[model samples]
Target: MTSDCLFCRIVAGEIPATVVHETDATLAFRDIAPKAPVHVLVVPKAHYADVAELAKADPALAGQVLAAGAAVADAEGLTQDGFRVIFNAGEHGGQEVFHVHAHVLGGRPLGPMVSS
Candidate 1:
């Protein structure tokens, strides 16, 4: 875990977050600033700068992250109606935090995937 990464700090207990789900390999928490009614961030306990990095370093862990996000959606009752799991990459992808995280969003209708 990177000492300076925010998600790493949260995983390390140096920071506090409203965690919703956790496992040996992943942690799912509510987003501080919600974009939807049910917006949660699912991340691997071990740090990865981005999704590409995570997938390259540990594909199993990357799959676990996806599973964890799905689990979060299930727990939040987003499975039936559908939900969105997003992994923003660099600055152009709107990734504010360097750590790889999947944003599980639901609880309402989401419009277009991207706006022009």
Candidate 2:
């Protein structure tokens, strides 16, 4: 785990987080700045700068991340109603944390992916 990565710290147990689901390769936790009632971030325990990098480095692990996000949606009771999983790429893509993670949002109707 990278010492400077927030998600890495959370994965390492160096920091406390409201973890909801965990898998061999992933971790799911509540978002501190939630956009939806059931907002969670599903991340790979091993740090990767972004999704592209993660996908390139370990495709299987990347798949695990996706699975973990879906699992989080199921655990949060959002599966029946549906949920959104988002992966913002770089700075322009709205990724604040460098580590790769998927935002699982639900519990209410979401806005359009893009507003015009």
Candidate 3:
């Protein structure tokens, strides 16, 4: 786990979080600074700097993250009307968290998101 990564601390139980779902490989929690009505961030347990880093290591892990994100979107009741799943790959993409995370946003008029 990264010493200064907030999500890592949350996963380790060092920090408190309202977790929505968790499995062996992933954890879904509410974003501290949510941009949408239903903003959840699903992240892999293992530490990967960003999507670029994750993509280079294990392609399966990438699938797992996406699957987890889909599961969260379903659970949050956004399947029919739809939802937005986003991953900020790098600085240019506004990836502040560093660790790989899929943002699940829905429950309102989503309109056009920052990215797909």
Candidate 4:
């Protein structure tokens, strides 16, 4: 885990977070600044710069991260109502953190995908 990466710090226990779920390969925590009623950041234990890097380096691990997100969504009671799993790729994609993480969002109907 990188010293400067926020998510890495959380994974390494250097930073405290509201962890909702954890596994050998992944971790799920509530977003400090949540955009939705149910917003969780699910990350891989091992550090990767972003989704592209994670997918290229370890496809299976990438799947594990996604699976963890889905599991968190289900446990959060969002499965029946539906939810959105999002991976913001880069700066242009709205990714603030460099670590590879997915945002599990639900609790109410989301608006359109994009707005001007």
Note the clash tally of each candidate: 0, 0, 0, 0
lDDT of 2 by residue, 10-100 (tens): 9999999999999888999999989889889999999999999999999999999999988898888999988899999999999999999
Every model's TM-score: 0.96, 0.95, 0.94, 0.95
What TM-score does prediction 4 earn? 0.95
Instruction: Identify the runs in model 1 with alpha carbons over 4 angstroms from their true place.
Output: 114-116
Give one digit per residue, the lDDT tens place, for model 4 in 1-116: 88999999999999999999999999999998887889999999999988999999999999999899989999999999899999999899898899989999988888866222
The whole-model C-alpha lDDT of candidate 3 against the native structure comes to 0.89
Tens-digit lDDT track of model 1 for 17-97: 999999999999999988899999999999899999999999999999999998999999999999999999999989999
Clashing pairs in 3: none
TM-score of 1: 0.96
Using alpha carbons, what is the TM-score of model 3? 0.94
Badly placed stretches (over 4 Å) of model 4 are 114-116
Candidate number achieving the greatest TM-score relative to the actual structure? 1
Off by over 4 Å in 2: 114-116
State the C-alpha lDDT per candidate: 0.94, 0.92, 0.89, 0.92
Better of 1 and 2 by TM-score: 1
Clashes of 1: 0
